[model samples]
Target: MNVTICVGSSCHLKGSPKVIKRLEYLIAQHHLEDQIELSGSFCMDQCSLGSSGVCVQVDHVVHSVTPSTVDSFFQEYILGGLAS
Candidate 1:
């Protein structure tokens, strides 16, 4: 999966930078660099909610996400038992 984080002005202020760093570290630590691709993104038009959140994209499907809920999102969806 490739995780694209919106780093627009709003997102930056909301704390996407920290999320990016945390995810990067996790990817590296888990040796998921090959399984995942993390990148900075422009506004996905969810700026109304601003930076207080994150987003996860698998293939082309995008999910509105937040830092606090990322763990469950990953565990239940990304790394969950369901096959894509």
Candidate 2:
């Protein structure tokens, strides 16, 4: 799976770093290092939507995310059939 998290100014201010850290830890904890490709990007065009400015794209679907939401996001999208 390809996971890209926005690192634009808006996202950065919203805690993209924290979100990235949490995701890294989770991916390692679940031994998904090989199955997941995580990276950072700039401006996903969702920053103006409010809520957490962090926008995560898993494959092609995008979702507004935050550090606190990483675990649930992983369980539902990364580890579950939703991703497949």
Candidate 3:
């Protein structure tokens, strides 16, 4: 699966960087670095919703993400798929 994280100006100011790092670490922990393609996006137009925070794209589907729920997002979308 491919994961695209938004770290644009708006997202950076909100805590997107931390989210990215967390995902990176998770990928490493689960040995998903090879299966998961991770990249940074400029923006996803969700910033207007207060911090907009971050966006995560899995398998071509883009989901509006935030720092608060990023862990669940990864567990449910990224790692969950691998387990199943």
Candidate 4:
């Protein structure tokens, strides 16, 4: 899985650094370091759409991700996606 996080100005203020940290920890905790590839990107343009959290792209599909949503987001998107 390729996880792309938005590090643009909007997302940086929204806590992109924490988001990146949490994801990295989760990937390591779950022993998915080999399967998951994490990366960064510029603006995803979701902020203009009024999305609540930072934008994260798993593969190519985009999703809003906040610090609060990190765990669940990891469970459903990363772990769950790997399940199937």
Candidate 5:
């Protein structure tokens, strides 16, 4: 899966760095380094939409993600796919 996190100014202020860190740690913990490709996007337009969290794209599907929600996102989108 290709996961892209918005690092635009708005997202940065909203805690993108922390979200990225937690996501990295979780990906490593799940040994998904090979299965997942993580990257940063300059702007994804979610900021203009007034999203509460950082804008993240999983396989081109965008989502509002935060550090606190990283675990569930990973579990459902990443790990859950592995189980199936």
Candidate 6:
């Protein structure tokens, strides 16, 4: 899985750092370090529409992600797929 978190000025202000930290922890917890490719980008062009001012791309799908939503996002997109 490829996960890209926007680190633009807007996203940074909205707490992208926290989101990144939590995701790192979650990926480690699940032992997906080899399967998941995590990265950061300057802008995704979705920041203006994001309620949290942070945009994340999981594979090719863009989502408005915040630190609080990272857990559910991981569950649904990461772990959920593994279960299936």
Which of 1 and 3 is ahead in TM-score? 3
Model 4, range 1-84, lDDT digits (tens) per residue? 899999999988888999999999999998999999999999988886426788999987888889999899999999988998
User: Candidate 5 lDDT, tens digit per residue, 1-84?
Assistant: 889999999989888899899989988987889988999999887796527788888886787877788788888876876677
Tens-digit per-residue lDDT, 1-84, candidate 1? 766888777777767777677767766776778788778888778775443466546567666566666666666655552345
How far residue 66's Cα lies from its native spot in candidate 2, in Å, is: 1.2
Residue 40, model 5, lDDT: 96
The whole-model C-alpha lDDT of candidate 6 against the native structure comes to: 0.85
TM for candidate 1 is 0.72
Estimate candidate 6's RMSD in Å. Answer: 1.4
1 or 5: which has the higher lDDT? 5
| Clash number by candidate, in order | 1, 0, 0, 0, 0, 0
Global lDDT scores for all candidate models: 0.67, 0.84, 0.79, 0.90, 0.84, 0.85
Measured against the true structure, the TM-scores of the candidates, in listed sequence, are 0.72, 0.89, 0.80, 0.94, 0.89, 0.90
Q: Best-fitting candidate, measured by lDDT?
A: 4
Residue runs of model 5 more than 4 Å from their true location after superposition = 82-84
Q: Which candidate is the best by TM-score?
A: 4
- Report how far residue 42 has shifted in candidate 1, in Å: 1.3
Instruction: Give the higher-TM-score candidate: 3 or 4.
Output: 4
The true-versus-predicted C-alpha distance at residue 8 of model 4, in Å, is 0.3
lDDT of 3 at 41: 85
lDDT score of residue 72 within candidate 3: 91
Ranking by lDDT: 4, 6, 2, 5, 3, 1
Note each model's CA RMSD in angstroms: 2.7, 1.7, 2.1, 1.1, 1.5, 1.4
What lDDT, from 0 to 1, does candidate 5 have?
A: 0.84
